[model samples]
Target chain A: MEEEAKAKPRNPSGPRLCCVCNTRRAALKRPKTLDQICRECFYEVFEEEIHQVIVENQLFSPGERIAIGASGGKGEHGLLSINLYFCSVEDSTVLAYVLSTLNRRHHYGLDLFLLSVDEGITGYRDDSLETVKRNEIQYGLPLKVVSYKDLYGWTMDEIVKMIGLKNNCTFCGVFRRQALDRGAAMLKVDKVATGHNADDIAETVLLNILRGDIARLGRCTAITTGEDGPIPRCKPFKHLFSKCISRFCSGVHQGFGKNKVVSSLTIRNCGLQKPRAILDIIKSGEDFRISTSTKMPEQGTCERCGYISSQAIDRATKVIIPGWKWCKACVLLEGLNKGLPKMGIGRSRGLNNDRKDAKGNDNAAKSIESKQCGTLDF
Target chain B: MQLTLEFGGGLELLCDSVKIHKVSVEPQNGAEMLTMKDLLTWVRTNLIKERPEMFMKGDTVRPGVLVLVNDCDWELSGQLNTTLEDKDVVVFISTLHGG
Candidate 1:
C-alpha cells in the first residue's frame, strides 16, 4: 500500500531528465554505464561511440571501398513509440545503415557497398534479401549478392532436404563463411564489416572456450581479423551491447530454434544483471594466453579450392578428399556432390573412416552453429 | 487503462506475427492503479500466443527484451514497479533474436 501510493502520475515532476541533455525525459538506461538519457542524446552518444571506435582503431582508410556484410538483420519494420524511431530490418541492416550514416556524417571518404550472401533458403533469405534490397536503394549503395547455388551448385533448401534439419546449420555456417568472402572478393572491396556486437563476441568467447578452440579463442576478441587473408573484417560494434544495438537498430524476426535459445541463455542472463560483463568476458578472452607448444593448426590454402583453410594435410595420400586438405566449405560441398552427405560434417582427421568422422563432426558443428545466428560463424 | 503494446525484433512472431495490440487492462483485485508488473501478467496471459519464454523470464521480460513506456525505457521509470496511466504506450522489443 505504501509503494502503491508512491506511484507517480504520467507527467509527474519526479521523472528523471536525460542525464546528458538535462531536458527531455530519459528514455533509455545505458547498459555499459547505466546512464539514463533521452532518445536524442542516446543516438548522439551511440553513433559517436561507434565513430570513436572506428577512428581509434582506424578501421578504414579514406577513399577505400568497404563492403558491409548486410544480412538485412536490423530494423526491418519496428518504430519507436515516438516518430523518431526508424523502421526495422535486421542486425546487418542496421550495420549497413549505421556504417553508411557514419561514413557520410563523418565524411570518412569511403565507398560503401552492401554485400549479402543468399544461402538459398527460400522463405528466409528471400524475405531478408528484400530488406537488403530496400537498404540498397535507401542508402544509395551498390548491392552484391553471392548465392550458394551459384558457387557450390546447391541451395540451403536443397542441402537441408538432402541432409535434413539436424546438421543443416553446419553446412550453412561453413558455406556462409566462404560465401561472404567470395562476395566481398567479387565486389573487390577493401574490407568487410560484420554486425557482431559485444554480446555476440562474448557469446563467441564462451562458445570457443567451451569448445576448446584455441585458434578462434585467440583471434575472436580482435576488433579486426584475417588481416593477412584476402579480405580483412572489422566489427565497429565490437564494444556496443546487443541490447542498445537492437533498441536503435531494430531486429529481424526469424525462427527462434531451440539451439539458439540455449546458447544465448547463459550470456543473455548474465548481461541482464551486469551489462559490462559482456565486454569483460571479451577482455578476458583477449587476455587469454595459449601456450605455444599446444600445436595449433597451421593456416594454409586448401589445396583443392585455394580458399584459406587450417585443415591438416593427408601425408599418406596426395589426393584431396573429404578428410583431406580442403576448406570446410569445399569439403561440405564435396560431401553433397559425392552423395556422401556425411563427409566434412565433423573432424577431418580420419582418412579411412569418413562416416565416423562425419558423425562426430556433425555434432560438433551443430553445437557451434547453435551458438551462432545468421551468417555469423566462428 | 488503454495501452498500446508493440512488439518487434522478432517478438512479434510469438504473438501470431501481429506487431501491435491495443487493449484495456484494469488492475486486478480491485486495486486503484495498475503497474507494469500487472500489465505483463495480463499481456502474457492474453497476447502472447506462443513461446512465452521468449517474451518473459520469471516475472519481468527475458533479459534481452527492452521495455519502453510512452517512448521512455521502463528501467528509467522503475521497471516492473513503474505505474501505468491511461493511454500509455508500452513497447517490447527482443534483441535476443537475429544476427
Candidate 2:
C-alpha cells in the first residue's frame, strides 16, 4: 500500500511470449495492473487440457466441490477467483472451486491468505483472525486454514530444529504433500489440484533420477493422480512449464501493478541445486530416447501409511502403516547421509528402457482402467 | 591382465580396491582361462562376505566398475562363458547417472 513498495524494478524486463503457447504475451512481463490476459490464456489452455483428462477419466463428478490448495502464492492464491472468473464465461458447472485449508507454517498470517487454523500459536491464529475479519468483507469465497503443528507433527521451525535447515525443506515438501491429501479428505472434496507446473515436474523428474530415485521418477508426470492415497490429486499445470508459469505471474503483476495484495513468499532453497548436475541425463534421454541403465527396484508399501514406500521390502508384510504417506522424497529425507540408494527409494523408474519396471503399485490400476479416458492417458 | 572395472553412483561402497576381486587362470599346456560368471562368483565369495556393504544385491553395474575380460560388461554375456585371452583387460568403472 506504500509508494516505495510499489516501485517497479529499474530497467525491469519487458513482457515475453507465454511459455505455454509462445505466441501470446507471457504473464511475467506485466505491471502491477490487470492486463493478465496472456496469463489467463495460458491458464485457460492448461485447464482445458486438464479438463480433458478429467472428462476422459471422469476424475471428477458434476456439482462436486473440489478444493484447490491455496498457498496465497501465485500457484494457489486467488485460484478460485481466477478460475471462477473464467468459468463464469464458459458456464461449466462440472466443477466448483472451494478454498481449502491453508498450511499455516510458522509465518501463519504473515503469508498472503485469510484462513487461519486453531494451532494455539498466538500470533499465527490472531493474524489469521485479522485476515478473516479483513477478507470476509471483500472476498466471498469460503476459506479453511490448516495449521503447521497439526498436519505435520511439527512446524517448519520445529522441523528445522529437529533436522537441520537443509533437511527441513524436505519436511515441508513431504508434509505439504501428505497434508494436502489429508486436508482434501477433511474438506470432503472429490479431488484436490495443486499449481505444480511442468518445470516443477520436469525439474523433479531430473532430480529424482540424478539421485537415482527410482520410485518418484515413475509418479511425477501424472496430471490427475498420485500413489495410493485417499484422495486423487490433479496438477492443472502438469504440461505448463516454468517459463510459461512465470510469464503468467508477471503479466498479472503488471496488470495489477498497484493491487493491494502481493506475493509475500520467503522460502527459497527448494532443493533445486541437486538437478543442476543432471542436465545431460535429461538432454540425452530427449536427444536419444535413451536412459542410463538402473537396477530393478523393489516396491513395497510403507508400514506406516500404506503409500508406496520402497523400504517395506516384503510386499505381504502387514504393518500398522502410519497415518502419513510420504513420497520417496520424504522417505529419502530421513537420513541425508545415506547417499543415492536411500534417497533413490520411491523415485521414478527410468533412465533406460521404455517400460519402467514398476517400483510402485499398479494393482488397482484396473479399477480405474475401465474408466480410463482414452484421449487423456497420462 | 589390466581389466578395468566400473560401478555407478554407489559403486564406491563396493570393494575398496577395484581389482581386489580379479582372478587368474592357466590354460592348456600351461595356458590360463577365466569367465564373467567366475568373476561375479568371485566377487560374491571374497568381497561380499568380508565387506557386505560394498555391493547391493541386484543393481545394474556401471562402466566405472567395469569387469572387462577384453573390455566390456561381462554381465552382458559370456559370464563364466567368456574365455579369458592373453593380456585380457577386465576393467571396472564407476559411472555417473546424470541427465
Candidate 3:
C-alpha cells in the first residue's frame, strides 16, 4: 500500500504539470474546464469560484443565522448543506473543510447550524442519518433532526405501505419540503442553505417547462427561493456543478482534511440526462420571461397552516372545502388520515365529485393538476 | 498484475455489499501494460454482480461515477488509457445515491 501510494507518477519520463501554477504535478482534471491542475491550484480556483458566486449573488449577510439542510445521504448529488464557521486553519480540502477554515481565515461571522430531516425510510434514511450524526460531531455543528413520523404522524415506510411504490415519492417530496421549512423555523435561522447544484436546478427547469409551470420556471433558476415564505432558502451550490461537488466531497471523504472516517457518500448517478442538455435547460430557463398579461395564480397564505402558496387551497382541487382552506400539505395529511389516498391527487375534480356526499357542496370543481413523483414542486 | 479495488458511494450494493476486493488482472494477449479500460472490463465481468448498467455505460463508467487510481483522480492520468502497475489501488465511487 505504501509503495502504491508513493508510485503515483507512473510515467516518470515527462511529468504532467498543473496548467495554472505550471510547477507542481497535476492532481486532477477539472470537469468544467477540463484543465489539469495541481491540488493547490484546484483548491484556490474552486474556493474562489464559490466565493465569487456567494458575493455576486449576495447569498448571505454577515451575522445571519443560517440553517444548512443536510440530508446526509448522497453527499454531493444529494442535498448536502454547506456551513460557514471560523477556523483560522489554512486547509486545501473542499467546501466543508474550506468553509470551516474560512471561518478563521476570512472571519465570516455567521452562525451555522445543520438541520436534517429524517424521512423515516427504514434501511435507507436510517443508514444515512448515522453519517449525518458523524458529520455533526466532526464539524462541531449542532444538528436538529425532524422526523416524518414526528411532524406528519407518518414515516415514509408507513406511507409506502399505504400508497405502495407508485405515488409514495409524492408524499415524501411534499412532506420533506415542509419538514425542512419547519426544521429551519425550529432552528430560528434567518436563512436556509441547501446543497442543490446547477444540475438539479436545470432538471427542475426542464420538468417545469415540460409541465407548463410558467410560474415555477420563471423562479426555479433563482439562487435563493421562497424568500417571501417563512424561512428564506438559498442554494450556494446553484452555480456550482454536481461533478465538482462530488469531487470535493470525495476528496474530503478520502481523508483530505481533519475528518476521520468516510462519513459521506459522494458518488451519485443523477439519472441518464446528458450534461449538455442540463446546461441548455438552465440557459433556456434563464432566458424565459413570463408575459404580464398571462393569467398566473396569485400568492396567498393557506388558511389552515398559514404557509405561502399561489393557490388558496391545495393546487389540485379548485373546490374550496366548505369551511377551511387547507394548504397542499394539510390536504395530503387529511387524505392520509381519512383513508382517502386519492384525495388531492390527479384529476381532483373526479375525486372531489365522489367525496361531495361528505361535504354536500355541489359547485363545479376544476382539476388543478398534480405534479409527478420525484419532481420538485417549487 | 495484482490490484486493490475499493468500491464506495453505494457501489458496494451492486457487488454483494463488499467494499474492497484484491484481484489479479492480466493484460490482453499482446498488450504489455494493463490500462484502465482492461481493468474496467475485468471488473464488469468479475466484480459487479448486478446492475452492471449502473457502473458502466458504453465503454467507460457512468458519467457520475468517479474513478481514482492510487489516490489520484483518473482524469489526471489518461482515464481509460491510464496504465496500472502491480498492487495499485483503484477506487470506484458512484455519486448516484439519494441526497
Residue A12 CA displacement from its true place in model 2, Å = 20
Off by over 4 Å in 2: A1-58, A71-140, A246-378, B1-99
Task: List model 1 lDDT by residue over A1-378, tens digit each.
Answer: 112222443445666778998987666889999988877788889889999999999999999999988642211110101100111235567777788889889999999998887878766656667778888888899999898899999998999899875567667666766777888889999998887788877877876665456777888788988888788888888898888877776322232211122224378888988888998999999999998776665666787788763334433223443345666666678779988787655443433243435566546655554442332311
Top model number, DockQ: 1
What lDDT score goes with residue A213 in model 1?
61
Off by over 4 Å in 1: A1-13, A72-89, A250-263, A309-324, A348-378
Q: Summing lDDT over every window of 10 consecutive residues in candidate 3 chain B, give the lowest-scoring window.
A: B90-99
Native-to-model Cα distance after best TM-score fit, residue B89 in candidate 2, in Å:
68
Residue lDDT tens for model 2, A1-378: 122211311112543344556664432321212223344564465345555654566554545555655431111111011111010100111111212111121111211222223323333235333434434443444556675677544555554454442333333444444454556666776656555544345455554454344544555455565436455666555443332333333222211111111111010112122322233333432343224564554554554455542232422111213454444434544433333322422223332223444422222222322231211111
Considering only chain B, report the TM-score of each candidate against the true chain B.
Answer: 0.96, 0.45, 0.97
Highest lDDT against the true fold, candidate: 1
Q: Enumerate the candidates' DockQ scores in order.
A: 0.43, 0.01, 0.41
lDDT of 2 at A43: 48
Query: For every model in order, what is the number of clashing pairs?
Result: 13, 84, 14
- CA error at residue A280 for candidate 1, angstroms: 1.0
In the order shown, the candidates' Cα RMSDs to the true structure are 7.4, 23.1, 7.8
Candidates sorted by DockQ, descending order? 1, 3, 2
